[model samples]
Each structure stands twice: as C-alpha cells, then as structure tokens.
Target: MDTVRETTSAIKLLEQENIPYTLHSYPTENGPVAAVDVAAYFGYAPERLFKTLVTSDHKGGYYVFCLPAEKRMDLKKAASVVGVKNLQMLKPEIFEELTGYTHGGCSPFGLRTKLPIYVDHSANNWDAIYVSGGKVGYLVEVQPKVLENLVDAQYAEFTK
Candidate 1:
C-alpha cells in the first residue's frame, strides 16, 4: 500500500494563493535528512535547492533566511540586511517549538509566527527553486518572486 501524504501548511498557503508548485518526496531511514542530501536524492544541482534557517537577534527578535543548500550564511551580512547589530542561529532545541517545523523541514512560508524573511539574491538567477515543503521527506518547487511575495521576503547577499 502507498502511504498518503498529508498537505502541509506551506502547501495549503500556496494553494490558497493560487501559486504553482511541484512537490517531491524521498524515502528516509535515518533521522532528519540534510538539505544537501535531499538535493542529491532528487538529482538537482545544489544551487537549485534552498534551505530555510532561523536566527535571532541579540534582542530575541526572530528572522528567517533562505539560501542555497551548498552555501553557508554570512552572519555579519545577514545581520546587516536584517538591520540588527548581530544575529545568531537559533538553537536546534527550540527550532520546532518556535517555527512549528522540524530542523530539516523548516520553510520560510507558514511559520508559527510572521517573521521577516530574507532570500539569497542568487535565487533570482533561477526561474524556479526548491525549498522544504514544511516537512521532512518533501520539497516544494516554486518561483522565487511568488515565494518572496507570499512571505514578504527581501532579497539580499546573505550567503558566503
């Protein structure tokens, strides 16, 4: 028997807005799958897949960042883009509680709270990009502009 996939909040939001997206799923035996591994499993170039990261400012304000799976976020640049003195990655322990999504499954869309989102400027190079589908084992392909509009994201040079 085939397992039925339940719609994630991210998917629901996209559907409600009439945005086009494609869902891709992969099997997992171990714990949370890394974004790079997911991109490999789907036979996609690293630049075609992006990952969502949550960070907090010194004052405890939260922000979300989306960047290519192959790149590391430049904390200093990210802080500047977010208009904070400094920013740090949120603790893994509070990831799910704060974002309502698991560590490897966070999406900029449909977060537990409305937070400022930043997407790496490089994403503009692609007509479409894949991001987590608000769950492990799945990804959603969408146009960058639609995603940015839906999440009120700003594009910036935040990746190193």
Candidate 2:
C-alpha cells in the first residue's frame, strides 16, 4: 500500500463529512479499466465492488446507477423506473464534462451534473462496497448507506 494519498472530489467530500472509508490504490493504467478488474485487484468479491454508470435519454436528461461489478444493467427496466422510454450509456467522449470524472473514475458523490442516482438493491447485501475514488487506480471502501445519503439516491432492482 502507498503511504501517499491522492485527493479527488469524492475523497474531499468524505473527509469533509467525516465519513469512514478505506482508500485502496493500484498501478495507474492508460486506458479505461473495467469494474471487475478493479475488484480483482483489491481481492474483493465482485459483488462487493460497484461501478458507477451514467446514462442519457439522448436528450438533456441524465441519470446515474451504481451496481455490482459482476452484474449487468437492465437498461429497459432501469429506464422504466425513471419514466424514460429508454436510456443509453453515456459516451466516453463527454464523460468528464458531464460527470467531472473520467470513464472508469466516476464516483456518484462528485458528479458535475445534478442527476438522479439509483443504486442497485444488491448493494445492500454487503456491509461495505468498493467504488471509484474519483480517479483511476483508486477505490474507496465505504458503507452503502454513506453513498445513498451522499447522493440522495434510491435503491432499485435494475440489474440482471
């Protein structure tokens, strides 16, 4: 483990709010990193690691969902929950502009856009889940409740 700590919007928020968390780090990679790979790097079960996904209605509306790394999103059903006919994964080209974080580094806490956040119900199955630390190669181990409260998020059965 590295003794040096890196700062990111998510980490800042955790510090400011006095939330308890364990920060984990890995070698920085040049391209997009997959959620499952991250979990493997930390030796955590895939179910206890989450990936933050941003979707758009192809209009101006956008939404966020956090789900287990090993699961797949049920796009059609997720759209139905938000009353949107459909939802498309957000483009990597503008991920940073929209969320203030890179593709694999998006954390629900520090998104630039004020979008609705939905956490998969499965997250409650773990005492703590690992999510991006607002940067690639970094992750934060935190209680699921901290995430919901931080983002005013809801729980949904949106994964298959």
Candidate 3:
C-alpha cells in the first residue's frame, strides 16, 4: 500500500481523529485535469470521485458543494439549499485566496475557515468516496460519513 509521510492539514486532522482513509497519488499532467480524468486515471467509477466546489451568494457568504465528478451542479438547487437567492462559482483566484488551496486541490477537510458544506445525496449510495487531498495529483479515499462528520456537511440533492 502506498503511504504518504508528509502531512497536509487535511491528512493531519483525519489522522488525529483516527478516521480510516487511503491516500492515492498520480502523476501530474501538463495541463488542467478534471475530476473525471482523475477517476479514469485511478480506474474508479466517476461517481465514486467527487469534486469540491466553492460558491458565493450575492450577500458574499461562501459555501462548499461536493458532487459526483461526472455531474454538474444545479446552481438553482445549490442556491436554494443554502437559502440564497443566487450563487456563483467562486473564481479560482478567490477560492485559493480564501481556502489556501488551489482550484484543483480544494478539500472540504482543511479550509482556512469553516464554511457550510453540502454534499449531493448521491454520495450516500456509496460506502466510500474519493476527494482531493488538498493538492493536485493526490486524493483521499474515505467513507462518506467520515467525510460528512469531518466537515459538518449536510447531504442534499444539489446536482443536475
């Protein structure tokens, strides 16, 4: 089994809580890589891999949403779930600035601050799911409940 000795804040917190998880590493590609691509690279179903998205309401409140790699977030549903009139995806620059992790590396686990997180209901069907490991080219496999508890996230139908 592959293990990472270096600790990211996300990994450290998981370890401290004794949550069971597995670390996965992949070679970095030359250009942008999508979550679906990562899933394919790891030989996992796209639905088992999730992408963490940061969004902001018109009032400037930040929220996080996790959905299957192959699905698109339903903006209207996402806004409704968060009780906002509207939501816009946070710009890459703003996301990195606020979360301290780049676009492809954002994990709900160890953000600079605690933001409300909403995971798509579909994830509940899986025993475990994969999410970014706070960096590009790395992923963490963890039980959905473990991830939900770690981030205080709620699950809802927020994907199209």
RMSD of 2: 1.7
Question: lDDT per residue, candidate 2, 100-122, as tens digits?
Answer: 99887899887787889999998
Model 1 Cα lDDT, one tens digit per residue, 1-160: 1257878888788889988988887776773377787788778998989999999988989999999999999999999998989999999888889999988889887888888889999999999999988888778999999767898898999888
* TM-score of every candidate relative to the true structure: 0.93, 0.93, 0.94
- Writing each residue's lDDT as its tens digit, candidate 3 over 46-136 gives 9999999999988889999999999999999999998989999997778888887888888878888889999988888999999888888
Off by over 4 Å in 2: 30-32
Going through the candidates in the order shown, the clash numbers are 0, 0, 0
lDDT of 2: 0.87
Error of 3 at 58 (Å): 1.2
* Model 1 ranges off by over 4 Å: 1-3
Instruction: Enumerate residue pairs that collide in model 2.
Output: none
